[model samples]
Target: MCIENKYPHAETTRIENTLGQRPKMFEIDMLVPNGDAFEIKWRDATTDGDHITKEHTRLKVIANAGYHPIRVMFYYPQREQARRIQKTLETLYAGVGGHYYFGDSAWQYVRDYTEVDLLAVLNRIASEKTHGE
Candidate 1:
């Protein structure tokens, strides 16, 4: 995958020694740049609902830590599921900075990594404040 330096190095955080937790660790996918933090969730139709919950908790914790939490949810796989997840994400991110990309198809979200240059859409998103339409 083409690693773009546009985003800062991601730090995955988890609650330590929390055994027997159904969700295990809440991996906080983040890019910290200029002292601000952005949270990313690359999800497909098959993505577990639990993952979304965990990510939201992680975002809340990040915000509690005094960092700007930007939640970016990339939903692909199916239009109907994408729309569902997009709406859910919108509600979760109300008043927060974030965006959701409902890809036309799964390939659209992975084209670049698959030698199809599909990342243009994601690149534009990474540069913009939000993703819609």
Candidate 2:
């Protein structure tokens, strides 16, 4: 089965296999083959306004899907809040079987898990800017 988010919020792919009546589908934020199922929370998505406990629910869904759901807190200029956010994400990830990252280190963790060449992408952007491309 093919899963696509196409939702304003985070996306999950509906992985499935035919069983009895229909296919068993799992909606995970991101399920990389033998890698990680990721749930990215930007800003104060966890405790902002009425969003308290929302992240927890999302992570739970991933876990119920039989995937290790990783929660990544994305906080940039608000580095001071990173410490608090990291604590929250860590606590949740600990309860689950996945992992988490915050602050400047967030991108690094995601890159490692997703196996994306972030440095190369950034270098290409820099080169283009330098060469006015």
Name the lDDT of candidate 1. 0.50
Model 2: weakest 10-residue lDDT segment is 1-10
Candidate 2's C-alpha runs over 4 A off are: 1-11, 14-27, 41-49, 73-83
Overall lDDT per candidate, in order of appearance: 0.50, 0.57
TM-score of every prediction relative to native: 0.47, 0.58
Worst 10 residues of 1 by lDDT: 1-10
Provide the lDDT at 113 for model 2.
Answer: 48
- True-vs-predicted CA distance for residue 119, candidate 1, Å: 2.4
**lDDT tens digits by residue: candidate 2, 1-133:** 1112222333456654322222244445555654467655565433342232444555565666577776665563355554565566578777867677665677677565446655467789999999999
